[model samples]
Target chain A: MSSTPLPPAAELARANEELRHQLEEAHDLIHAIRTGAVDALAVQGTEGPRIFTLQGADQGYRTLIEQMNEGALLLSDDGTVLYCNACLAGLLQCDLSEVMGRAFADFVPPAFRDYWAGLLLKGWESKSKGELPLQTRGGALVPFSVSMNVLSFNETATLAVIVTDLSAQREITAIRAQVEEQNALLDRKNEELKREETARLAGERAAAEASRLLEGISQIAWTVDPSGANTYRNRRWYDYIGVAPGEGPSIGRAWRERLHPDDAPATLARWNESLRTGAPFEVECRIRNADGDYRWMLGRAQPSRNAQGEVLQWIGTYTDIHEHKLALERIDQGQRELLNYNEQLTRVNVDLDNFIYTASHDLKAPISNIEGLLDALLTELPAETVAREPVQPILHLMQDSVNRFKRTIELLTDVSKLQKEHGLPTEPVDLAAVVRDVRLDLEPLLQSTGAQLEVDVAAAPAVMFSEKNLRSVVFNLLSNALKYRAPGRQPQVHLRARPEGAGVVLEVQDNGLGLDAASEQKLFGMFQRFHDHVEGSGIGLYMVKKMVENAGGRISVSTNLGIGTTFSVLFNR
Target chain B: MPLQKLTCVLLVDDDQTTNYLNQLLINRLEITDKLLIALNGQEALDLVQAHCHEATPDCPALILLDVKMPVMDGFQFLEAYDKLPLPEKAAIIIVMLTTSLHPQDVDRVRRLNIGGFLNKPLTKEKLNDVLKNHFNRHLPE
Candidate 1:
């Protein structure tokens, strides 16, 4: 028994009016009972059954049932609608009589008749509740929640039911379900948006990193659109060219403007061809910087194409190759200078040979004339007529001078001949034959000197040399050996040839007055002789050396003073 | 002497001393009755012309020609003499006398129409050999 508190004055006045109307209706109901219109009042209470006079306060429970907001009804075990409140008739949209005798199951849709039956079976308990659609007067289905209980009225079993309209609850439940669905959809969309944002940020970061890497490289990087318009340049491009941002347009135009005039036309032609054909482009040209100095740059580019093979852009680089070009030019200049110097040296050598030739040729006549005069004088002035020839010794000395002079002239001629590279043809000469011939030629000298010549040409049989030059070389060496023999020792000469390394070595070993280290140093020089006592022009060994060198050979000497000397001639293959 | 007497001798040289010496040697040998001297190839040509123009010409039996002279050299004279008449130049013993026995000069002389090449100052023995080879006369030893 919880009592509601009094409302405000505005609601109290409405309540007082509603109570007066209810009293009038209650008065009319009492009047009807007194006139025998209303007979009895029956109620099924928690305590069981109760019957009361219509005039008593027990009738208020009937009134309360009729005035309740929920529909109230009672039914027989056979499913007949035995009793119903005004609210039940109103909720069904029908009169009270129309509801009173109809089957209770008739108000439920046919689809829910079995559910009503199941509810009725379970109505023996204190109460049972179920949801079902009820049929309205207009033949529409209205959803309701029904509570039913098995009760006894007037000593007979009946069912008491309470019905609640569930359309509003159903609508509210549908709205809540829609809100949950909307929330799920919103959350999914928000997640997708967040991922998209993150991907966009990552892509931007990657592009930035790629740009930074391109700028960090030393070479200038640039890009052009498919139309050959300059689209982008890396930071290094500005730094290298000393240009401000956005100054250049249409790389072709900028290149033509800054390119060395000598290189522009060709470079542009190649560039245009590449652009037209979408082919890779490469060229070396001088590019001028902001300081107006030109440096050689090697530019190369390749087109980026789409799947359809349409060119999208071009990526290119320019590399500085100035230093390398300059280095090559310097090397070329040096080679040219070296060739000129070689030519000049060759001319000088020819001039020297000519001078020697004329000088030696001119000196011979005077020497011969002096010798002839001396001979004539000696013959004409007979020893008996002289009595005492004082001029005779002077004449002999003069003859000796003429002879020496003649020998010097002959040596000069030989030297000049050796110096000329007149392509003298060589043959394989038998050293044995050469030695035998030289020995025979020196027979008179050998007999006079009483020298023993030992020949051993077995080691190396033949050598490649000019015949005339070999005869001269052998004659000079053998005569030297015979002339310069040790005072008390008979000249023992050994001429041998053998292969040493890649060349033939000829050794003329003699037991002669050997040379000292100091003499050996100047031994092969022009007019150099170790023993002045011997009759020599001091030019034999020098001629031999020149002859050997002219034939691309070398000569060396080994000697121990007062012991022996060996001259080795190495003829290269 | 291994050489016989000759009708006359011709000396062609650029140096007076060389000619004089050669003439003295010829006289000493007593090989020729007369000796004619010319300083160069041009003078020698004039002498030969003069001898040929004479009514009783004293044609030289031997002509000793020296090389390396002014006006005309030995090879140049030989080229010019090739154009001369056969009667004026034929049957004359021409010897090349040169101080330079350089192989190239000798090669030049070998290509010429000469009896021999003698290196100066020419010895009596060399001259005797030349006379025996060309004149069919041997010097008395």
Candidate 2:
């Protein structure tokens, strides 16, 4: 309001400097107010200059900032800490007075100094946040998230920084990471346990399947341990023994109680030997069945061995063989009886042969004696008595009777001799030669009967027979053919030999006074005569049959009445 | 040539008729001056014991034996004769005469100390053969 004079040059310069300094102070004051850095201000009033404060109006907000868990701070543009909350001081492990008016960068570790500087520079431009480790008063580094904001009150700038005390947060993060690792380990252990459980279950299933298979077999199958303790038995074993499931007797008791008394000892001995030697065992024994009857059984066992060639167990089976054994015993008994019968028959035959021989011998002596006596009488008789008609005829008749009797006795002797020759040694006899000899012997008879004799032995020439027997057979057959000739026709005879099955067949065919069926049946009987017209002792055919049969040959005669007769003899060699 | 006559000839058989016939044959042959007959081998053995106790002309020189008998057989007599105490018993000529040529009888006679065998119904030819073979003498034809 008052006028003033101009000052000099040096003095005016000094005055201008003072005024500029004052103007700068005024600007700072305005910026501090706008930025809310100053809580109170002093102003000129009407009466006097008065001081004013915003403490009452912002008390709740100020208290909230002081008690916040986050560390709060106000910093100058040059990184100097102008103000700090208690929480910030507590976070740094320092007093609030010590933290105030210090460079905020001083609390940052050396390794993070550049990052702090960068955060401050960015904070001046806009909002900025960063994570870094800050050194506490105790010299331990703690992780912190720093959030910075540039506060401007009409160009008066300050940095508002929120620092999270990351110690608790870092502990939480470490704890969480440890928990995740433990969970992963637990998962791996669980997977391994599942795989092991699957393998164990599979092994158990296989064991169960093997046991089921053993139960299905038909034979009385069983198993025993190396020590001969019975381990397992099939269902069939239980069924055959008439025992309930799981109720069978032990092996020792079974041998004593179930096996027949006579067989138990042998069965046990064999089993013991097999066990001791580790060899396969087999036995035939009688066992009492469910019906309390003893039956034959064939028991067999084979040792099961391991890789070391040591016996592990024995597998066994029992088979019934009762019926077969009984049948064999019966057959043995029958054979013994048959042999005894054969011996008795042989004895009887021998006795009969001896009797026949003795009788014939005795009979022959008497008959021959009679003939001799007759001869003596005839020799003594006078020639005149022999010439008398009736006396001569009677003498002739008597002589004929005596001759007949003698011949009969001689034939009987031959028959008895034939029985003795049954076992005589035989040789291959030429049938042709025998036939030739027989023909010569019968030559007179053949000529008298005018019988044509034909001989053909080309087919089968030899037979295994006694030579004497063969001669007798041929002679009898040939003579009969000539002797029994037809009265009206000349007798024709054919003698032939041929081969049969493993033998020779000789056939004598004759055209003679063939007999009827009735006469032919008795033709071969001793002392049998078919034709009254022919003179015969009737022993010729009988002797022939006997000789042929004794030499293991058979004679069969086929005849047509009054036409022809054929005699076939089959000789077995 | 006619053979020298024997001192004695014995005939044995179970049948009387057979013995008679054998005796006649020996007589007709003129082979022995003395002839004896027996019904069985036992009777013949008794006759032998009575006459042939010593080796002399009285002892039988020839014996015609029959096989079958009730008390004893020809074979039985032969066995007893072998044990006899008579001196020169081997000198006696024994000939078997039988109705049967049974192989058993013939074999038994041959095994014995017999000179020869003859079938039943004694004949001059048969006797001559026996006389010539055993006694070095034969009946004349």
Candidate 3:
């Protein structure tokens, strides 16, 4: 190398060649420092090892590595320790000199030796990262996460690694798993608590329902022990018995005092029998009400048995039967009254029959004798004496009086006969024939009155009645119709029979002297006659009514004064 | 008119007036030659027995019986009369007379074997009919 001047261009070129030689030497030194290929170079009086430095930059990087929380190390291709930072030596719990030149596997636990070997087997071609355990010289274990990288320099291989202790991360993961397990346990306990609460509420509801049902029943319900001591009584029992609530067991014994005196002994005997035998108890007895009056009560009890067939208690109810009992008593009383009334009626009927029989016999006998005497007198009288004017007229008058007396007796006999024959059997009677017979019997009177009779029995010709009674009814009615004829107008009479519903109607209409309101009111009564001039015993219409009514028929008369009179009889079929 | 064949007649009645009037009528009719009178069936029975035991030529030819007497009624007399011997009853006519025309009385009279039944206050015509019908004799004018 020369320090010479050269031409402005060529001399400058020679001078630049000398300066380029000096620059090439400086470049080689810088390159050698950056590559850290230099050996046996130490930064004196420092912990830095035999490695090149980037002057002040290398110092900062070294400090960074030394203070880092992670452990840092450098290794040869064979996994031998080349350099390790203070953090790495501290992580292995060893001195820097003792860590140097030691194989990396010596710091790894025996459990992780193969894992470390697998990382070194990758050589310097790739970086390997894993979690591993490191064993200190004291035989203590340390957990670490390590990252290793391979670098080649001048065809020689080396490794760069980062090691992190992992104890804190694992503690955090275990805490999370324990917290999740605790939450699941809490959920199961909460479900069990809710189910228990629901069961308790249902039990309370069942108890309430039983209490409500006991109060709602109609009968007086009670319970007693097998010894006949009261245990419980429902609200109805207290209300019906008029006893205070919470009354003691003695209340049951007090009930005996309220029983009717007549029924007490028998009821007690029955109760004793039922108690001895454990049979169902039943009785109908009189119980005193709140008003202290005895009333009928039907009481019944059944034993509540245990599984062994021993009586546990008695459940009983008392039902009031007072009204029903009273009704039965009233019915009995009514039956007795009816029997008495029937007996009295029978006696009266018998007496009346006897009176009529005796009176008819006594009265008719005398009349017949008188008639015989009159006949004898007439026959015994001399012919000249009987033919004399005054004597004959007087005799005629006497005969007339006798005839009148005989007629009266005959009518009275008919009435007695009617009463005696009241229960005679009836048959189908031709009403038109009865009317015709009556008309023939009254023909002399009919001719005297010039009465015309019109019979219209075509609709319903027959009726169910006693023939004798029917004939009497027709005869009396026809005779009355003729006798009561008006002075001017010819007497007109109509007899009609027609069907009405389930019966026959017999109507006798007459255009004779009619009846006034007062006379009509008094019409069907015995001995009641409307006309004073008419010769009537007043028994005809009464007899007619009695006969018709006795046969279960009805008769009604409609009359207008001086116009007409009509009599309607409804005869049941 | 008068009955001729009847030799004697009996009248039985509780009433004195009835018996007297019957006797007078019998006398006027000349129906019987002799007249016998008694108060009741008991008395009439004694009269008939006395007359029959006397064995008179014309023992009471006719007997009049009345019902409803105080001591012995007509029916009882008839029963007693039946106990008499046939000779005492032979050729004698028995007739029943009653004031009652009651059907029961008529029925009872029919059951008795009497010659006839007549109403009370008996007249001559009835006497004549009894004589003619039973004795087969006519009345004299």
Top DockQ hit: 2
Q: Each model's DockQ?
A: 0.40, 0.53, 0.16
lDDT of 1 by residue, A1-573 (tens): 249776889888999999999898778877865674443344445697553333434666767876888898877667777677777788889997788768888888878888888888888656799998899999988889999988765466778899888888899999999999999999999999998787556644544554576677788877777788876678766776677777656453365678999999999999999999988999999998767899999999988664567776787888999999889889989988898988888888788888888889888777777777776777788786544666766776777888778878887887887776456777888777887898899999999988888777687746778878888888988898888899997889988888887778888999999988999999999998667788878888988888788778899999989898999999876
Question: What CAPRI class is candidate 3?
Answer: incorrect
**Each prediction's Cα lDDT score?**
0.80, 0.79, 0.77
Stretches off by above 4 angstroms in model 3 are: A1-353, A368-396, A433-452, A527-529, A532-537, B5-8, B45-61, B76-93, B99-109
- Cα shift from native, residue A452, model 2 (Å): 4.3
TM-scores, chain B, all models? 0.89, 0.89, 0.89
Candidate scoring better on lDDT of 2 and 3: 2
Ranking by TM-score: 2, 1, 3
Question: Which tens-of-lDDT digit does each residue in A439-474 have in candidate 3?
Answer: 788888878888889888888857889998889888
Alpha-carbon shift of residue A29 in model 2 (angstroms): 71
Ten-residue segment with the worst summed lDDT in candidate 2 chain A? A36-45
**lDDT by residue for model 2 (A152-234), tens:** 53354678899997779888989999999999999989988997687556544543554477677666767777898876677
lDDT of 2 at A326: 91
Error of 1 at A278 (Å): 11
- Give DockQ: model 3: 0.16
* Ten-residue region with minimum lDDT total, candidate 3 chain B: B1-10
